[model samples]
Target: MHGPLKGLFAWRFVVRAEDDVRHPDGRASTSLRQGVRHQDPEPIVANFILDTASPHTKVCPETLIALRYNGDMRPGQSATVIVQGVRTPCVVGRPGEANSIGAPFIVDGSLTFYFDHRLDAPVLYVDDENADLRCRAYR
Candidate 1:
């Protein structure tokens, strides 16, 4: 197993756009598409997953807590999020829900470098300004 990420991991990246999130329970019942979801019925912000192969960001519980999106959680909840100019779908879940990384908001989806294979693991970047989320591979 890889070592745990304690400190010295945070970056700045804006939420380019919100995408269509899908889950096994079907599409999440939300109306957030493009920009941050301010009045989400259950408002949420989280660290998303990123890989050299993927182009979208994923959400984490801490991010959710940071964004304040606390409500029913379902697996396979996909969202069509955008980063830079790439539009990709983002999946959602709870702590143990499907695709659950067990780490709340490790990458806020906007920042890439989650699976760089060069570092140990992904790190969560919590920006003080507006609690913006982001991710970056360890150097």
Candidate 2:
């Protein structure tokens, strides 16, 4: 399939530390506010952290339950994920409580991290094909 670069594929979100929150009473909250999103028709739309070190992409059990996805567990299952208009075939698996997109999605795709020297914030870039190689190499 074609890559995200050919389509509109990009997501942006805010990040805050656990200790960096203000309560209604103007008190500092110690709990972390994890990034999350929900959309209709699709059933579930939770925020996921991209982990380049991880070997496989995984979704939280809660997300699967929320989606009401009743597929066979044997050998896992494949799902078509439409990101920025690009339909991608992804292998779904159960991992921890948090949803994470790992190297499995990146090895064949292109990734770029934008960082500013003055800020700790970063922006992630994804493309269907490896920009460096111009195409995905399979062994």
Candidate 3:
């Protein structure tokens, strides 16, 4: 008795920092957290973990520090995040060292993750394309 296995496991997302972005014009963007925001220090690729329960996108504090992210966010702040070559101005902060790509980013980017569907791998799909594994723009 053999059949296709089925289960919903946490899917991981890997993305690279396209560049350091800051609040444009310093006009107090309501889209961002209600506080002072700053520009990114540097840009570098980072890995992420998908979590639907999370309300905002979270990056490792170490990476934020390395990138010179100087924003005021107890939860997070709006920043430009590049995923699978897709860019979106979303909230990101140094919640920890591990990148936590939460529902906010996924919903904003319209991404999908598949599992237990007779698939050959564990990965998130952007616009229904497996471009995550072969994105050159990020490189």
Winning model by lDDT:
3
- Candidate 2 residue lDDT tens string, 1-139: 1353322222332211112334569986322223332212243346665666777655544554454444332234654333322223445666544455666555445666665457544566664444545422210
Q: Which ten residues in a row have the lowest lDDT in candidate 3?
A: 1-10
Instruction: Give the number of the best model, judged by TM-score.
Output: 3
- Deviation (Å) of 2 in candidate 3: 28
Segments in model 3 whose C-alpha atoms lie over 4 Å from true places: 1-43, 70-80, 88-97, 116-121, 128-139
User: In candidate 2, which residue ranges exceed 4 Å CA deviation?
Assistant: 1-43, 72-96, 117-119, 127-139
The number of clashing residue pairs in each candidate reads: 32, 2, 4
**Model 1: per-residue Cα lDDT over 10-99, one tens digit each:** 333333333234557786643343344554333333333223343333543333434333333354454343332333345654553212
Alpha-carbon error at 119 in model 3, in Å? 7.6
* Candidate order, lDDT descending: 3, 2, 1
**Which candidate model has the greater lDDT, 1 or 2?**
2
lDDT to native, each model? 0.37, 0.43, 0.52
Model 2 residue 25 distance off true place after TM-score fit, in angstroms = 60
Worst 10 residues of 2 by lDDT: 12-21
